[model samples]
Target: MKAVLKRCLLGLATFSLVAAASGAGAADPFPQKPITLIVPWAAGGSTDILARVLSEHLTRSLGQPVIVDNKPGASGNIGSAMVARARPDGYTLLVGSMSTHAMNPALMPNMPFRGVEDFTPLGLLAYVTNTMVVNPSVPAHNVKELIAYARANPGKLAYASAGPGSTNHLSAVLFEKMAGVQMLHVPYKGGAPAVVDTVAGQTQLLFSAGTQTLPHVRANKLRLLAVTEAKRSPLLPNVPTVAETVPGYELSVWYGAFGPVGMPPALVTRLNLEINRIMSLPDVKEKMNAIGVETATSTPQQFAAILHRDADRYGKLIRDLGIKGE
Candidate 1:
């Protein structure tokens, strides 16, 4: 009887130890599997390229493969909505842009998710250098000349945008309002298509990212007038800025990472730290510079502030311009 009683106690003790050990082992690290970074744009565009580059670096740093899933549509709404609705487990993330996060909520009346409220802001990744370029046949060499011609042509000249409410569209709209010109607006499904059309003369002008336009410019297919940043890009130092020609006109296109709202604060901190570290690397900077993007990094708080400020600023702009989503 004593031996039987002792065996029963030992079995209970063994069971408890095994349970505790199992629980401890189950408390694995944050990223136990691969991560998916959603790029809310078509593959082969500037956003896609940047996301791919960042994913490669992240895979190396995070010990798991970071895959880019392209979900391009509705000027980035489709993919963004997916991220907004994803589980806040940090595995499903977004590589978003200023257009998707800041401008779309204001432009689209029926957005599926609230831009600021539905996502956890990670950090700013980089700024895409936008440039004003025209088909060589348009015969404009600089921003001033282009504006003068646009003013003269009125509704005759046409400019292509990635889509309605894209930064490309807003940039041109701001240019028109500031310069007092009225060129026609053409919307395309994506930046690559828009730039291709511009190069093929389907559109007369394009305010596009340097990644899509630089190759054409180098090939003498599209003529670069001025960069859209407040200052000249080191990539094209000799080229002036649109702000240089039109004072107080600045539109910056930025990219950042995001996860669904309610993501663990610890996870967000980990991602921000890792991403900032990646951005600070020399090779990352060089690669970004080569693609006409300047790498940038910020704390999660700072990135949240940027989203709020830009949403307010661009919301007013969209309302005043009467822009709508398609």
Candidate 2:
């Protein structure tokens, strides 16, 4: 009996030692190597710019280099899927947007990864308002005028979008449905061409990010109509929100970071903390403001909730509108 008791005690001590050693190893300072952040969009787009800014800050905070890889295609599906399928280690990250993380899953028929289930939410990086702008030659000066002109012209009035199933396209479609107008949609390879065409008078209107359109607006190439948000954009203080004229109209695009599902909770927490801290820095805030992106920092739980809510919203809209994938 004495020998058996001694053996049992020895086993328990050995098990405890092993557990302690494992815990220590697990908690060792993470991000010992460089991290790769994937931006599922073309270079120079809002998502890419925001990802680059974040990569710079994270490099400083984590004491390791951070690289941005732009993999733009399928309205942000290809790159997003890559991240969704990557290993759950903290090294691989995704810079997700409304199109990649929320709307595409709702609109596309064969989305490989579940927006809410296939990844771990890190935190919101930034949010920006989409602006409604018209070519200088257009007669419309505001939302009301634009609506009237579109109704009068019907199919004659055409608008441009970044691509089919893009947020830019969805925003204009929702406006048409709600405002009871039937303007034409012309999809371009991306926003740069669409905005250029709008400025060149090839297209009449567009709903695009403030950062991208602000320069053209300032150049007097396009006239401001109304922002696609509940509140007026800070960059364009004098401009009114579309809701101000077409009641209840609200839309905005936000960016965030995520990792493959089942990432260690401790790792998630550490990442969320570091990124959120960087987002709130004064320099970061100033740079984002100069580019028309509003700072939005949140806990991982809060970001996850936002993803769920936005996914449901876009899913219903896509179903009702019968939007299909390209």
Candidate 2, which segments miss by more than 4 Å at Cα?
1-20
Candidate 2 per-residue C-alpha lDDT over 1-326 given as tens digits, one digit per residue, 9 for 90 to 100: 99999999999999999999999987778787889999987898667878898999899889999999988877778888898999999999999987777888877788878888899999999888789999989998989999999999998899999877778888998899889999899999877899999999999999999888888888888898889877877767889999988898877788999999999898999999988898899988888888889878999999999899888887788888888757
* Leading candidate by TM-score: 2
- Best lDDT goes to which candidate? 1
Model 2 — TM-score against the truth?
0.89
- Candidate 1 least-lDDT 10 residues: 41-50
Please write out the lDDT profile of model 1 over residues 106-146, one tens digit for every residue.
99888898989999999999998889999999978898898
lDDT of 2 at 209: 90
